[model samples]
Target chain A: MAEIITVEHPEDPRLGDYTSLTDVELRRRREPAEGLFIAEGEKVVRRALAAGYRMRSMLLTPKWVEVMRDLIEAADAPVYQVDPALAEAVTGYHVHRGALASMQRKPLPDAAAVLAGAQRVAVMESVNDHTNIGAIFRSAAALGMDAVLLSPDCADPLYRRSVKVSMGAVFSVPYARLDPWPASLETLRQAGFQVLALTPSAQAEPIDRVAPHRMPRAALLLGAEGDGLSHRALAAADRLVRIPMAHDVDSLNVGAAAAVAFYAVAHGRPGE
Target chain B: MAEIITVEHPEDPRLGDYTSLTDVELRRRREPAEGLFIAEGEKVVRRALAAGYRMRSMLLTPKWVEVMRDLIEAADAPVYQVDPALAEAVTGYHVHRGALASMQRKPLPDAAAVLAGAQRVAVMESVNDHTNIGAIFRSAAALGMDAVLLSPDCADPLYRRSVKVSMGAVFSVPYARLDPWPASLETLRQAGFQVLALTPSAQAEPIDRVAPHRMPRAALLLGAEGDGLSHRALAAADRLVRIPMAHDVDSLNVGAAAAVAFYAVAHGRPGE
Candidate 1:
């Protein structure tokens, strides 16, 4: 069972991990360096714990303590019950969902390991938006895509906003950053995966026409919102695919596009 | 030619339509009541005008005056030139986007009218998040879905955040609020449409299994994120369709789900 402590002072040194929560750049640097990431609200906190992530500690308002009693009873970490005002003071935002947990982040799995037996995978390049990262993880997990491979510049999938937006699916969908980016894509190709770059270019074949599931394995590569796939990344892909657009609309946001592309790879051309 | 009028004060009554924009409830009531909606940033403002929405006025920082010279030369509306500080003071947030426009809201087209010649459409129920609304509109437009029909409870697609998020695709896609709830859904059926309710229920047919385009006309019905399709809406649907999620994932965010569903309806089961 966890040890419960009551904290009155907002300046408590033990609460350091939760401080400066809203400072994006600082937290981005400090969290990874400190080997910790935060999960906000009851849902995300519960999910992180359920995913086998070790809890460093938990901070909760009095009301949420009873709400998260099951987790409290099973956890080995210390629990600090603090005033809502103190939580706001420490996190620099209102703790409206009433609970936050700081969890020890696990080392990223080797990309080859995640790809070894995987049939469908998503590869993101320079998708730096945290929300897009979260949304894509959620779709990849739900659509039964086996795993995710990120370019070096993709945002952290375990970031607080990403965890909340993904409803913790980031934990279920295994992912690793591909270090050398375009060249590192060789990892998937060597694993018998057909790497397809998703683009809005007219010259690319429509995604449905590709029927990716017919291949022994497939990886769908996506890029940032405006610039799309880098020229080098596009050249690295085995084939270029597109979701046919209409009405002169520019393109779907990367998150939406990822969902559609994931679904196409998963089930659009069944009976392969 | 647009009249360029310099406004030195944030308190000027001429800026009424642009005030308290970050306040969701107030802007929700005010923008619609005044038969006006706001468009933020350069791309969205340009799309709004191209969609034939009359500009009541344009507010731009001095630097953007030359940037929007063509618009100024073409519009008869007044352009208020304000300092950066005054723009923030009036809108309650940073005006980093540098331009804002108040555009007249056209009367919503009748649901039957939008469905008359449409092959594919999206029906949203209680999807109150402006971001989801915007994302859905964007996907619907790009995926070649003809129009959108919203439950009266759904968020306004023309809301400033929605407009900006959709990249002004909301202006290109025709939409109308379906009054009288599920009863108004009858309007689609009466127009010879197959209404398919999208749910995450395991027993529901996989979305790809239902080739909507093979039908004479089709409407894909979606619900909000957490609590999806109400009992009554499900009962009203001609068929219940699902996306077949894996990994014990609860559900996809409604926005992502809508994109996949729209593509399934638009491009799935070709040559059927």
Candidate 2:
């Protein structure tokens, strides 16, 4: 059971984790360094708890306290109950959902470890937008990708906005960072996975023609929205594939492209 | 040639078209009532012009004036020069793009008119979110969808946010509103299209198994994010199809789902 403490001051040291919540730069650096990630709203908090993440603490408005009573009872962490105004003052935004939990972030598994058992994986390069990261994770999970590997420059999936946008899919899908980028991609090739780089370039073979779902093991590579795969990253892949476009439309947003590619490369695999 | 007007006041009558852009309800009603839509940024404004949307006026910061000199000299509409602060004061947000164009909204083509020459189409039901609508349009255009048919309650594709997010794809892809909803869906069937409803229900056949790509004339039906196709909407469809999901995930977001489904139903059609 958790102890309930009423907090009144915005500057309360006990509420440090929840302060400056709207300052993306500060929270981005602070949360990862402190090894904690915020799960906002009841759904994400519940998801974090269900995913076996340890709750460091929870901040809730009076109304949310009763709503989250079950989580509180099951949690071993302290619960801070604050007024709505105090909650907004501390967080720098109106706590519309009125419940938030700070959860401990476990060390990410190594890329090799995550790749060892996975047949279908998504490799993202320089996808630094938190919302795009979350959306890709949600699509990757839903469309049946076995795992995700991120380039070192990718944004943290556990960022508050990412967690909310993903509807907590960041917890459901296992992911790891690939350091040294294009060179580290050799790890997947060594693991008997065909690495296919997804690009909009006309020189690439059509993704459906490649028939990745038929492959025994595959890693589909994606890059940032605008710049796409770096030349080195593209050079590292075994092949380049593109979703067939029409009407001379420029390109799908990264999230949409990721979803389409994930479905093409991962969904409905043989014997699945 | 367009007349260049120097507007110092944010509340100038000529700037009325760009006012309160952040107020969704106000813009939603006013833009349509006035038969005008806002296209933001250089790319979108250019695309809008290329798509034959008549420009009512243009608002550009000083730096953008030289960059858009060709457009200024070409358009018959008045161009208002405003500072960043004045643009923000009028639009209720930072005009980071430094360009805004109010384009005359042509009367939407009737459903039958849009469906006339299309072999593959997307039918959206009550997808009222501007961002989702924009994202779907972008994917529809990219993935070879021939046209889009929206239910009456769907958000306007030409809304400022929708146009910006779509990169002006909304103008490239023709769309029409289907009045009297599920009843209007019958028109697609009359046009020899097999209307396939996309859902996550256990009853739905896995989309790949159904091989929507093989269908000669297909219309993919999509619904809003949370509550999928209404009972009547589902019943009106020829078949319910779903993208295979993994990890016991609930469903993909509407934008992702639309992209995957569009690719399945429209990309690389026979004889295209």
CA displacement after TM-score superposition, residue B66 of candidate 1 (Å): 0.7
Give the TM-scores of the predictions, in the order they appear.
0.97, 0.97
How many clashing pairs in candidate 1? 0
TM-score of chain A of 1: 0.98
User: Which ranges of candidate 1 are over 4 A from the true structure?
Assistant: A269-272, B269-271
Model 1 lDDT tens row, A44-140: 8888988999999999999999999999999999999998999999999999998999999999998999897899999999998898899899889
Candidate 2 structure quality by residue, lDDT tens digits, A1-272: 89999999999999999998999999999999999999999999999999999999999999998999998898899999999999999999999999999899999999999988899999999999999999999998888888999999999999999998888889988999998878999999999999999999989999877888889999999999999999999999999999888846789999999999998887653333
Q: Where does candidate 2 clash, by residue pair?
A: none
Among the numbered candidates, top TM-score falls to 2
Q: Largest DockQ belongs to which candidate?
A: 1
